[model samples]
Target: MAKGIRFHYLHRDSGNYKKFGHRDFSNPNNLTVEEITQRIRQALIDTEFFYPEKVGIPKFLFHRYGDDFSWYEFESVEEIQTHYLHESIEGFIAKLLRDG
Candidate 1:
């Protein structure tokens, strides 16, 4: 499991990515697939309203980089939730380890 995950939002004011929040899960690899999905859902709740600079398209994502600096971009909460149902934990982990 990852040591931590960072949540970023494309800021409306500066038009750049800004760190909003993060979590350091304790033994995330031990978590069941459902537990992982639920945790992500709860974290994303109402985050669209976080640190708004102007009314525009929501550009929020959560990502975690491995020691090699490879990361996977989860474009939205809905996309994350949907993928979890169809993808295996091993496959997801592989993507996290492989993608940037």
Candidate 2:
């Protein structure tokens, strides 16, 4: 069986990073990386879970293992698009699901 990938929303303050929440696909097999990315982008824009006046835009991070993970701090949609083009969803997910 294949492992699933998960993403966590984080907030950084004075060099400290804390997890606020996470988005995990209930049926990961049916969801593609593009879909997940789009969902995350929408979440960022909605800002319903964040207080911009108090905390600013939050950072996004993904991990499926204790040590294997990637962090992204995007300022605009263009940057996210660029990252998607350069990073393969399969590869990223594979890394995420890898065990230490």
Candidate 3:
């Protein structure tokens, strides 16, 4: 009963996309959303994608597909460090670009 989560990020210059995820949940039903988010954040940080002076918060999104197909948009480094729920990344980005 392992839950799956995937991370997608776009390279600003190259316009290429990168993806990552975990499949073995060990007991997805027992895990909370916060725990899942923490693991995702840790994995991204380990990749040096959140370095302040370097890349900062990479333009990334996370998706949990299947029964619970959801999308998450990373706003900032601080926001990613905290736990939150998933929304539509594409919609969020569109709104930001349109409104701001």
- Candidate 2: segments with Cα more than 4 A from true spot: 14-24, 46-100
TM-score of 2: 0.32
TM-score of 3: 0.24
Q: Per-candidate TM vs. native?
A: 0.24, 0.32, 0.24
What overall lDDT goes with each candidate model?
0.32, 0.37, 0.32
Candidate 1 — which pairs collide? none
Tens digits of per-residue lDDT, candidate 2, 15-81, equal: 3544454433233244564665564454443422333222322334433345532343322211121
lDDT digits (tens) for residues 48-98 of candidate 1: 332221212233443232222112223332112221133344443333333
Candidate 1 C-alpha error for residue 14, in Å = 4.6
Report the number of the highest-TM-score candidate. 2
lDDT, candidate 1, residue 64? 35
Candidate 2's error at 12, in angstroms? 0.7
- For 1-100, candidate 3 gives per-residue lDDT tens digits of 2233333433222222334322111222434545545544544433323322132233235323333212223322211232333433333223333332
RMSD (Å) per prediction: 13.9, 13.5, 15.4
What are the runs in model 1 whose C-alpha is more than 4 Å off?
1-14, 20-22, 47-100
Candidate 2 vs 3: which has more TM-score? 2
